[model samples]
Target: MQIVILNDAAAVAAYGANIFATQLQKKPTSVLGLATGSTPVALYQELIAKNKAGEISFSQATTFNLDEYLGLTGDHPQSYRHFMNEQLFSHIDINKDNTFVPPGDALNPITACKEYEDKIVAAGGVDVQLLGIGRNGHIGFNEPSSGLRSRTRVKTLTKATVDDNARFFAADEYQPQLSITMGIGTILEAKKVVLLATGENKADAVRAMIEGPLMAACPASALQLHQDAVIVIDKAAASKLADLEFYQHIEAENQKLQAHLATL
Candidate 1:
């Protein structure tokens, strides 16, 4: 994993936006895997700025969100669909037809999950996936104990995740017990993955993901297996990582080595 420790949340977001912009430059019609939460808000804002400057365009890009509360209406204030619209879609030029959020209130959830995967396949699969690690290490809504090879499916939110997400809902009663999320296998298929974390609240999870054993207890640890995953975190979130200075030195040395190789 390539870990970048930025000075603060805004810097982390700027770095993530630059990564996304770089990918868009390579593939203008790229399919993007998106996540919703406090962590990605600033990144979305930076993308909006790029859109406004005409430095990047989303008109041809397609997006698929990571997860959504199973019983909530798309219009519900607390729904992931609502979150995406307010934070991203409203500010960008992406076509409404190319944006997809899993059907939260689908009566036939199994079929819905299958169809969602089919849609992604039809769209050429995601070129880059953005992720946020939950305090308990869940990715999307696939909480702990989720099989590594799981596909798009309905998941029962763990108490920790429910509590973590409760802040968005007006009341505890409004929180959904279930959610629809793309599985670990689906995420692993992405050509590139960028995971971001910003606050002290995420420090432990971030540390576990990069350093601890690749156990199912922390689902984000699965990224250790991805060849093209990069993790961008603010200093606060990287606090628990051991030998952080060593990693920094290694990155610097590698850059110097690359420059020397280019000259030769």
Candidate 2:
């Protein structure tokens, strides 16, 4: 995992958006694995601005979201599908038919999960997967203790996850305790992964994901095994990482190397 600590959340969002912009410029048909949450809101906003400025276009791009609540439909106000539409899709030129989200209300979710995996494989796999690490180090709703090699499927949400998401619903409304998410192994198959986090609430998860052992207990730690995974965060989120100075030195050296290579 390449750890980058930015000055603030806006910096982190800009950095992550640049990754998507570069990828889209290089491969217009690139497949993107997306995540939903407050962490990615700013990044999506930046991408929308870039699209409007004619800096990047998603006309040929296809996107697959990481997860969806089990009890909702694509049209549901709080569904991941709607969230993506409101946050990023409606403003871009991408075909709505090209965007895929798990079938949260499918009568046969087992079959739905399998089909979701098939669609991903048929699309030539995700070029870059965008993610946000949960406070407990979960990725794509693959909560702590989730098998490292699991695939797309329905899984029960931990009480902690439900509580964390409670802020999004009314006090009387129910929050689904189940979700369909792409598995850790599935996410690792992507060509590149960009994980974003901000705020002090995420600092510990960031530390564990970047420096902790590669184990199921901290699902985000699985990124350690990926060849190209970038963890972008603001100082608040990166605060608990003990090797901050070393990471900064490495990034600086890498920048110098790239600059020299560009002149070659």
Candidate 3:
């Protein structure tokens, strides 16, 4: 796991955006694993601008989202599919047909989960998977105690998660208490993973993810076992990490090494 501490959320988004921009430039047909939520909003905006400027293009890209509310249809206002269309697909040149979000309205969720897994394998797997951590250190909807080697499936949302997401729904709106999400093992399969977090509210979770043990108790900590996982956060979000200075120093040295290699 690599930790990158930025000055603020905007910087974190810009840094994460650069990673995506570079990936798209290197492989225009890259299969990307995307995430939803406020954290990724800024990053998506950055990508939108880059696409507009012709710095990157999603014309040939295929995307898979992390999860979707179990009972919501694609056209539902609160569904992840709708969120993706509004935030990204509509703004880019990417073919909407190539984008995949777990089928929230599937009659047999069990079969649908298997099909979702199969689709990912057929797409050559994800080149880069983007993520956003919850305040409780959950990734996707795999709340606490999720199996470390689980796959795409339906999962019950924890009370904390439901409460956190309550704000998105109207007072009388029906909020889904379940979701279909990519499992920890499924996420670890991606060639590279980039997780972004910001704000002091995420500080403790960020610390547990980067500095905690590799246990299912903190699902985000599962990233510690991934071969290539990058954790990008603002200083505020990184406040609780024990080795903040060390992480910063390591990034600095890495930058210097890359610079030297560029000259060589």
lDDT-wise, the better of 2 and 3 is 3
Clashes of each: 0, 0, 0
Q: State in Å the error of residue 65, model 3.
A: 0.3
lDDT per residue as tens, model 1, 1-264:
888888999999999999999888878999999999899999999999999999999999999999989998899988899999999999899997899999998999999999999999999999999999999998998788888888999999999988887777776366789999999989989989999998999999998889989878888988999999999999899899897998788778877997999999
lDDT per residue, candidate 3, 176-233, as tens digits? Answer: 9999999999999999999999999999999999888888989999999898999999
Better of 1 and 3 by TM-score: 3
Candidate 1 clashing pairs? none
- The whole-model lDDT of each prediction reads 0.92, 0.95, 0.96
Candidate 2: Cα lDDT at 67: 99
lDDT of 3 at 55: 96
Per-residue alpha-carbon lDDT of candidate 2 for residues 25-137, written as tens digits (9 for 90 to 100): 99999999999999999999999999999999999999999999998988988889999999999999999999999999999999999999999999999999999999999
Best of the two (1, 2) by TM-score: 2
Q: For each candidate, what TM-score against the reference?
A: 0.96, 0.99, 0.99
- lDDT score, candidate 1, position 170: 72
**Candidate 3, run of 10 with poorest lDDT:** 208-217
